[model samples]
Target: MPIAALSDLAGKAECPLLVIKVGSALLVGKEGVRREWLTGLVAEIAEARARGQQVIVVSSGAIALGAATLGLDKGGRGSLADAQACAAVGQIALSGLWAELLGSHGFTAAQMLLTLEDLEDRRRYLNVTATLTRLLDAGAVPVINENDSVATQEIRFGDNDRLAARVAQAAQASAVLLLSDIDGLYDRHPKEPGARMIPVVEGVTAEVKAMASADSNSGMGSGGMISKLQAAEIAELAGICLVIGNGQHDRPVARVTGEGIGTLFLPCRKASARKAWLGGRLRLKGSLVVDAGAAAALERGSSLLAKGITEVEGVFERGDPVAIVDGAGQVLAHGLSEYDAAECAAITGMHSSEQAAVLGYAPRSAVVHRDQMVLK
Candidate 1:
């Protein structure tokens, strides 16, 4: 299907949240920031916001700009220290330029830098999600990048493609767009005589990955077709469609709708918000074994109450994900706990009103609210 009319894809959600990834090649040049390319793209982003869509920009170019400033070769096997130095220097210019450009258009640019550890930790992940949600709610555009300056090789994502995917998943975004040097996936090397660009991919299968093996590096960028495909896989699992397109042309965001030079990877079905919340996204801290009455209430779409809890297994703080298990030891659901393991252990099987009296503090009514739980 020629989705040149992206509304078809976007219609999947009202007030759709979109993640846009700008590669280093598109953002950096020998002369420095590509003012023309970025200005035009920012214009599209501005229009998109005016049209009521929430947009997040995941950008690269810190290392490239830093290399230029420090007289280092990014393409070479530079030491991690040298790379970090470049990121430190370039990040200032990168974030400032984005803020300036978006500011000129009456939009605020919120800068966020993240490392693998931030997304991997359950608590930090939720914190990041909250910040992003608030930024979007306040009508600010979030420009995020990898925290290369403080990140070690072990903790780094290495490529922003995966970073963008993880961030989009965390935000529970509706779609992701990777704007790069190439238009989209090709049947073979793009320069081949008859190689054709596949317009739409329903799912990321072995054949799709084989096609991605032909790298689409633009010399200055780190991610290629392989990395984009890896990103598509993440989007697929998150029930988010991803679009790959060339940002070299005018009105590049137009390509996101399946128009212009772009390819759309659509997920088979949309995953529920509950699944995205507790479905392997948040790392579980522990499990709470509840009595039969509590288990029945949970299945009936009720919140987890402290009075029904029989056992608390695991050392988890409040707001951490914990599984709810039945008396038979069968897993029932996963939800965020309102109380710490110690507190829950102490207040187990007690009424909610008794908690404040016993613990000398007023706690939320539910141990694990129904809204937070993903029932099995």
Candidate 2:
């Protein structure tokens, strides 16, 4: 298929939520912030906003800028403490520049610092999603960066590429644009003779992954081509398209706006916000084995009832994710269990009316409500 048109895409139903990730190399240089590039980027942002699009930027360069300000080697020989110090100082520089530039374009730049926990925890995830939505509704562009000042190796996203994917997924963005030093994905390293750029990737299969195996160090940014591909995989599963393109060109955003300027990774399918959060992209805590009748009901768009469950496997509390399977061992749907395993065991095969009698209280009738399930 021909690459999707960016202008046409910007008019889609979900286009209001567009996430653009700017890499460190493009945003920073030996002198610190790249002024000319920022001006061009701001112009694009102005155009996008005028078109009624709500833009979110996942930006890198905090540590690099911080290191530069401290007279340290960029992205090299920095201890964790030094890195954290750099981030603490650099965030101010980054956000200040963004605020000033965006303000010049008659836009407000809202800064957000995030850690992996913000996206991993259920409560925090909902909060982040709500905040982003509210910011967009209020006509402010949110520029997010990882909270490197406090993040340790074990808790860090390690790269803004994956962080951007998570942000796009949670924000229910129509698409993600990754503007980097390189133009797009290639058959092999672009530095190698005869290597060809792959204009579009419909799926991230094993073959597609193999092409990204080479180390991705851009010298200034933490992510390489491998990280971009990994981020693409995350976006694909969340049903969000991802675009990777060169951000060094004049009118960087306009370049990607044209046809074939980048590699677009199309989503496998569109998934609803509720379904994506319920269990479509999560790890299940347990499973419910139901009879064929219940499986058929599920396929017919019915909720999972306690009376339909034959067995429960694994230990899980109420509100935890669980897999629903058929008697023949076919996975049907994934959802949050309304009751803990103990309560479920007591209420198994019981009618809805019997739930309160057996468990002393019934918060909900369905073991997994239709609204909380995503059919596999």
Separate clash counts for every candidate: 4, 0
Cα-based lDDT at residue 50, candidate 1: 73
Q: How far in Å is the alpha carbon of 142 misplaced in model 2?
A: 0.5
Question: What is the lDDT of every predicted structure here?
Answer: 0.81, 0.83
Enumerate residue pairs that collide in model 2. Answer: none
lDDT of 2 by residue, 168-234 (tens): 9888887889999888999988888999988778878778887884355467888888989878877
Worst 10 residues of 2 by lDDT: 1-10
lDDT of 2 at 318: 86
Once fitted onto the true fold, the runs of candidate 2 whose alpha carbons sit more than 4 angstroms away are 1-3, 6-14, 74-77, 278-376
Number of backbone clashes in candidate 1: 4
Model 2 residue 53 CA deviation (Å) reads 1.3
RMSD of each: 8.1, 5.5
How much lDDT does candidate 2 score? Answer: 0.83
Choose the strongest candidate by lDDT: 2
